[model samples]
Target: MKRKVVIAGGTGFIGQYFNDRLAKSGYEVHIISRLNNHIMWKDHHGIVAALDGADMLINLAGKSVNCRYTDKNKDEILKSRTETTKILSTAMLACENPPPLWINASTATIYRHAEDRPMTEAGGELGEGFSVDVGKAWEQAFFNFKLEGTRRVALRMAIVLGSGGGAIEPYQNMVRFGLGGKQGSGKQMFSWIHIEDLYRIVLFMRDHENLSGIFNASAPVPVSNSDMMASMRRAMNRKAGLPAAKWMLQMGAAALGTETELILKSRWVVPERLEQAGFKFQYETLDQALAEIVKS
Candidate 1:
């Protein structure tokens, strides 16, 4: 029998990449989603069956925070994370042979907007505000589960850059349209990881049985917003670009149906634990990641 691996929320950008990669690697990759295909989130018995004797379970089930944080969105964003987490945990509890490894999705934004220092697993401080609060509650729901049979890990991820449809595409469009210049003050730190590296980190943790708990999944070297914009411009062969002021960004964000914090926040995160465990990142710098992503 093939090894079974379950991915919750396997329809999003990151989830699609993981599903494709794992399926190609010959594992029986099953998805637990709200969609009718594969396994539905409402199907408790289906989920329990999927988790039965599975090798790994990766939960990425959360509503997108890309839109405006209205009251309805906020409620949905919180429930989508916490409720889905509880449902999964409850199913795992019902299984006689639960998955050995459970990797839950968390965000690097859980840490404060630090400009003076970088946040790491060993020394990072949690931040306040709506996004941070959601992250805290999400992790709390996952960790509150008493699953002695499974090794749990909460991957605090940074902004993921990749080809086609992620952070890179918009920047590419901006550089093409001459809006590639920095947003707001442009001094805010931008912490990011190559999508491939994020996938590798999951496999790395699976291989290293000793590794468990919270680990920040970001590139070792984070750049400022100005630097990130400059790198994007360079990769796309653009010379001069238009910088957006805070007010302009606010307007743009409102028009684009997204929040400005996604662009303006200083997220200086480092993968301290991954490095200490001897996991080498494929794309260590933003330039390297942007170069390949732009090429594609």
Candidate 2:
């Protein structure tokens, strides 16, 4: 019998990757989304029916936080994460045989901005403000419920570098356009993981029966913004890049309809629990990851 996996909001970049990999692994994958005709979120019965008898449930449903965090966008961003997870929790609780494992998406932004050291699950300090608050509230919703037989895990992921659909694509495009230089002081740490490694980490967690709670999904080594941009330049065969100062980034973000904090924040994070669990990353360094992303 094939294992069944239900992925809520699994039509995005990361979700597409998981869909492909899980299908190849012989797991029956069903995507629950508003976009899909088969499984609409408004229908609670449909969601419960899809989740019933499934081996695992992974919720990646949330509004994208890449744009300017205006008042309306902020409300939607926080509500999308919490409300979607809340619905899933409620549906699972109603199930007589709910998924054995429930993996909810979290962010490394939950930790305070640190240039001094990397934040891990056990030793990291929590941060305040909008993005951090969203992360905290998201995790709180995931763990607030007590499903006796279900194991829960929050994937506190860092910036994921992939070929087409992640943060890397925009930076790669900037490098190609000769604007891919360090932002602000360029000393902020950027922790990231390859898409493949992230998928493997999901598999690792699925297979490990005892692994529960918050796990940081990121590469072991973290690079500074300057180094990361320079590597992007090298990978894309561009020698010169116009650096963006803080004010310049702020102005540019306003014009581009995005946020400056996305680039300026120093998210120095590490995957300590995954390391202790003996999971090895295929693309460990920024340079190697960029090279692969550019070539693909």
Candidate 3:
């Protein structure tokens, strides 16, 4: 029998891509989302029934963390991750025979500032802020779940770049109209990964049973904000000019309940564990990744 895979938030950006990839790879993919009035309880039970003789379970359901972290936004962020994970975990444990692997989505923002050094999975420091706290809570919820036969892998992803959604589309449009520039000092590190590589990494984790820990899913090369913006400008055949001031970012993001840290903070992260595990990146350079995204 072909392997069956269930994704909790499989209708979202990364989940959609992952589902498509798994389907193409011969795995029967099923998504459980709130859409179509698909309640968590009903979806969970249905998925459990489907997974009686299945292969993997991937949970990528959560609100986007890019918004302002106000009290309300913060609650949504925390609850979205924790609640979804909890529901899925409970369902899996209730299953007569759970899947073999459970891959949960995580973020690299959990890592603390490294100044100029890049963070690796082995001994990287975690950041201290609202976002970091949320990441901690999210991971903790997943860790607390009891699934006897399920192997878990937490993917600490970086800025995901793609065509329609994510950071690329807006930035690309801004650059196209000559409004795009570097944020803050332009020195802060921007660790990123192409959507293609991200999907590939997910597929890899599903296949590689030995990979059961936190994996930093980012490109091998970490670039500065200035370099990334310049690459974006080049990709759009535009010229770079002024950088967005720190105060301007603070003022703008303030209304959104976010601070300048979202843009100004430096996170020099590296996929040390993924590389060590013999995983390869399709786009290791910012320019190459930007070029591909633009062309696509």
Candidates ranked by TM-score, best first? 1, 2, 3
Indicate the worst ten consecutive residues by lDDT in candidate 3: 37-46
Considering only N, C-alpha and C atoms within 3 Å, which residue pairs clash in candidate 2? none
Candidate 3, residues 1-296: lDDT per residue as tens digits?
78888888877788877877788989987778878844353566676786666688888888877777678888988898888888887778778888888889998889886666888888798889878997899899998776687888998988899876776875776577675789887889999999999988877887788888788989999899888888888888886645678887788787656567767778789999888889989999988888878872
Candidates in order, TM-scores: namely 0.98, 0.97, 0.93
Candidates in order have lDDT scores of 0.93, 0.91, 0.82
Q: Which candidate is the best by lDDT?
A: 1
CA RMSD of all predictions? 0.9, 1.1, 2.0
- How many clashes (backbone atoms < 3 Å, residues ≥3 apart in a chain or on different chains) does model 2 have? 0
Deviation from native of the Cα of residue 73 in model 2, angstroms: 0.6
lDDT of 2 at 205: 87
Compare the candidates by TM-score and give the number of the best one.
1
> Relative to the unseen true structure, what is the C-alpha lDDT of residue 100 in candidate 2, on a scale of 0 to 100?
93
